[model samples]
Target: MPTPDFIRDLRRHVGTAELWIPAVRAVVVRRRADGRVLPSPEVLLVRRSDDGAWTVTAGILEPGEDPADGAIREVQEETALTACPVRVAGVFAHGPVEYTNGDRCRYLDTVFEMETLDGEPRVNDDESIDVGWFPVTALPESLAEDQRMVIGWALDAGAPAQFTEPGTSHTEAAGEPAAQHD
Candidate 1:
């Protein structure tokens, strides 16, 4: 993904300081039901140009930006799809990556379950090399496990928003356990 100019400028100013930035991720899904609310197996995924990893739409939150609005904006900017966030799925802190440019940072990411309101996904920006809907069951191996966990939670109907402690297993959260598959 192309680094936004604001971030590049911020990196220059911050130098090596360990800053905690706010970020957001959108898990855009559709429901395919037989007799109940069953989320479709497919969710939108983007291939990051930077690492070639397939993941959900996400970006850093700008100063004073609301997380919900940021989530919507990131989805449009990254995937060219209009998103209506149904609810927050998870909040997490991931970080300590030292950029090759010598800047260090961590992101407190809020993940949202969203429905696509309009527009089909295409590469809207250089952040993603490609964008498409993919089956959640057969997600690319390159996708991050944490991202997969968030998607799983988002697909579970009526799930409450979650705050996942960093480094803990996703199966252990602040509510009833997710449905088991047998």
Candidate 2:
């Protein structure tokens, strides 16, 4: 049997056909400075040059890239921040998404909480022309509904009401959930 088109695109980076899944990743960026969390937590976002819409720093993982490592790398590449993805914030299933370039695919987005180390980011790739930090309170009006939702959750990652799966215990301060967005 031949692989389906959706599956083929999903596995194009893979060396061989095996059990497979299509995935997306984003770095939920946060600043390390004090007094940063308040009425709104500013997060790094990029406006795609292709469609003129804003989105979290993200990308499809390469066949061999560790999912978590790819999240870190994508964020760095998009935001130009020296940061670390400290923990997985949550997973979201964004059913088929259609890109402006004619790529249609479903993605299971793995959101990661990232801590930044230095300087603000400049636009780093053709996917985007502008990148900057914005408050969780007033995210860009153009963000994709799904991207807005995940960024909203990531901002409240320091709160203490949301559920964190047991294995996500590597994070010491992982209980608080932020209010829903989008």
Q: What are the clash counts of all predictions, listed in order?
A: 1, 2
Candidate 2 TM-score, true structure as reference: 0.68
TM-score of each: 0.82, 0.68
RMSD to truth, every model: 6.7, 8.8
User: Which segments of candidate 1 are over 4 A away from where they belong?
Assistant: 32-39, 166-182
Q: Distance from true position, residue 174, model 2, in Å?
A: 26
Candidate 1 per-residue lDDT over residues 4-77, each given as its tens digit: 56677877887678777778888998664343655547789888887777788888877789999998999998
Point out the worst 10-residue segment of candidate 1 by lDDT: 173-182
The positional error of residue 115 in candidate 2, measured at the CA in angstroms, is 1.3
Largest lDDT belongs to which candidate?
Answer: 1
Predicted candidate 2 versus true structure: per-residue lDDT over 110-155, tens digit per residue:
6777777666689866667888877777787756555665665666
State the lDDT at 41 in candidate 2.
Answer: 61
Q: Give the top-scoring candidate (TM-score).
A: 1
- How high a TM-score does candidate 1 get? 0.82
